[model samples]
Target: MKTANNRLDIAIKKLYTAFHDDCLHPECCKQCAVGNILDHSDAWKHFSDDHGSTKLNYIGHVNETFGKRFNGYTPSELLLIEVTFLKACGYQLPLHFKNNKPENPTNKDNLFKGLQAVIELLCELDKSPNVMDYTKLFDNLRISKKSLVLK
Candidate 1:
């Protein structure tokens, strides 16, 4: 069984590859955030009829009931993660073309924003700090007292 951290690492790598390759998309199951995390598997689509819907379908509920985790994320968590990604990418929920979507879905900036949100969610799921967060590097507490005392 893979630990949450292991899953997070794998997810980050996959997302990085997808983003760099311009393969990430809000509409494509194999290219969406959850899809990439699941290694380009469309199996996650069975969790919900709508792409960005948080409400799971029968299969999702069944899997949730069985405590089945795909790459260390529950079915509901997967839906939430996808929804978060879609929202961050400026997409309207459920991902219908009629709904609002980024002007350029494949734009690197939009995909990066989506990936950032997804990574943060993944970190939350793993109960770990967001590896992408660099603000902590500027924390005053981490500075040495000696460094504060100028010669």
Candidate 2:
């Protein structure tokens, strides 16, 4: 079996490699949200500009557009909001899965290069996916009143 460290290394390496083409090239990036943020900030800014769209409008629009296709409020829509806003602010998040509907704190591991990344992820959470999946990260993670409130 692989050690935790080995698994982490492979995961990170995979993250970088999976996005290599989209990271450097646009045509391959296609409608990729994080790629757009990384390689095409200006265009992403158009979507996320001006403190950008709020969770209400942004999510509602997605619900109408892609949500209709997926059945409703999926990771795709949430990821779009997450990636677009983060990119507008200049942090390219990982687009790991094709249909990933990111809940909150989806990948705290994505430490982004630094503080800016953290803040962007925080802000995006305020605007999208209302669940805090990283409750598992806290040393105090447990089923309590707070956890229930958060849930």
Candidate 3:
């Protein structure tokens, strides 16, 4: 069971990845060189209110200073890659969400579910003051990488 502190730590790490890893210009080693993770979402205010910096909802490092950029991957390709990466990382993902749900949900349901779970958890944490302890909520939910089956 993850204590509130541990869950907070986990959330911070995920938020860091989501915020810092995306480079519209995949070749933008300059931004990577900066190695800074900035908050790109409104969740930071909520986190500050709770006196916890781990309640991350939507985080990303978007730099408008750079002009047009080229990332070798198309939008669809980026989504696929993100889905695969998250799955390989052991996060549950959702497959259904009304109009935007995937047709082949089973193919990467876990990945979607995992991503959704993270966002949802962050949202819940943002909204609820007592949601600091997420042990019961995330214990059985998050999978260990060791349990992943390489197929």
Candidate 4:
């Protein structure tokens, strides 16, 4: 059994690879956020009918009822993560053609935003610090302490 931390690490790494390879896509189940977390499996698509929808379907409810977890995330949690990714990527929920979407879905900036949001959620789910967060590296307190030591 994989620990939550281990699952989160695997998810982050997979997402990083997807983003780097420009394989992340809102329309492709195997390239979506949850899909990447599940090792590029499109099985997660059965969780919801719509691409970005959070409302679970029959399969999702059954899985959730059985306490099934895919890659350490429950069915509902997977939907939340996917919604977060799509939203951050500038897609309106449910992924309709009429809904708003990024002018260029594959743009690095858009994908980076999506990845960041997904990573944050993954960290939150595991109660771990977000590895993608580098802001702490520039903390003034740490910098001041370093300067004092240097002095």
Candidate 5:
């Protein structure tokens, strides 16, 4: 059995990948497998703002100044890449909203609750090393000088 914290942590981990994975590697790099893995180069060409900053983008930039990486990849292709990468990294993504009912019939309260829980958990994780792969992730993606506010 899992506690609220455990459940929330698990949910946040998935949300972390959902929100990031794309921006960590921009499309400006060399194209091919490496390029594709880094960022969907095609997506950036089609989506980046006037300046290189990836703000006004989609597919969940969250904290990363990012937009969606279109890169001429079909939705299915993107899905395959993300899924494969996650699997290779030993992550199994969340199911797309399984059979859970909301206490209120029409308000979408349950879904919103889950989203809120996930966002809160992710925010906590951004600061604390509470996530599962914190060491590996922090090492690979160096923290920015301004971003790390050590107490």
Candidate 6:
């Protein structure tokens, strides 16, 4: 079975490959001349000591003390958020099916449509407190939430 990092690498590679018209590139590389994936999330900023001044020291300070916004989402959770955002925006995620071939290759029109839908959905959710609670990464996306989801 593929590990989480492997799955993430695959997804990122596809995103990088497709946009650069490297459909037949056959592999992903750091010097792809288009895009590269890296960890830059709140969870990473709040946890890793490598971030130096930016690190929130979330474990020793935030969650261990007041349980502030530093919830320290796992790598898998981050991957889920990334993949979901891409899908919600109509990007074709490079997921392999057990039987049937995957459908819905992303195109410019579909991407625009998906983005429009996402914006409308967020706007609608903005008026409703209950709906926004399920989404934890909204702050990262610069979305404003008036209150926490109590459920």
Query: Among these predicted structures, which one has the highest lDDT?
Result: 4
State candidate 3's TM-score: 0.20
Candidate 2 residue-wise lDDT, 30-100, digit = tens: 22333333333333323332322333346445555654422122434434544443443334344233433
Position 80, candidate 5: lDDT: 39
Relative to the true structure, candidate 2 reaches a TM of 0.24
Overall lDDT per candidate, in order of appearance: 0.87, 0.36, 0.32, 0.87, 0.34, 0.34
Give me candidate 4's TM-score against the actual structure: 0.89
- Report the error of model 3 at residue 129, Å: 50
Off by over 4 Å in 6: 1-106, 128-151
Report the candidate with higher TM-score, 3 versus 5: 5
RMSD of each candidate? 3.0, 13.7, 17.5, 2.9, 18.0, 16.3
Residue-wise C-alpha lDDT for candidate 3, range 1-151, written one tens digit per residue: 2334543445445444643444311112121101111223222222112211122222211211222112322222223333333443343442223324323423334333444444444434335333335676666555554356442
TM-score per prediction, in order, is: 0.88, 0.24, 0.20, 0.89, 0.21, 0.25
| Tens digits of lDDT, candidate 5, 3-93 | 2455344434443443344322211232312134334344432232321222333432432333323433333333333333322332234
Q: What order do candidates take by TM-score, descending?
A: 4, 1, 6, 2, 5, 3
Greater TM-score among 2 and 3 belongs to: 2
Candidate 1 lDDT tens digits, 1-151: 1334777888888888889888899778888999998888999889988888999999999999999999888999999989999999999887886887778888888888999999888888889888888887677555765577754
lDDT by residue for model 6 over 1-151, one digit each (tens)?
1223443334334443444553311112221111122322233333434211223354535453564321233433323333343455443444333322214434445444433333333333233222224356666554343433432
Question: What residue runs in model 2 are displaced by over 4 Å at the alpha carbon?
Answer: 1-15, 22-59, 62-66, 69-76, 79-151
Q: Which residue pairs clash in candidate 6?
A: none
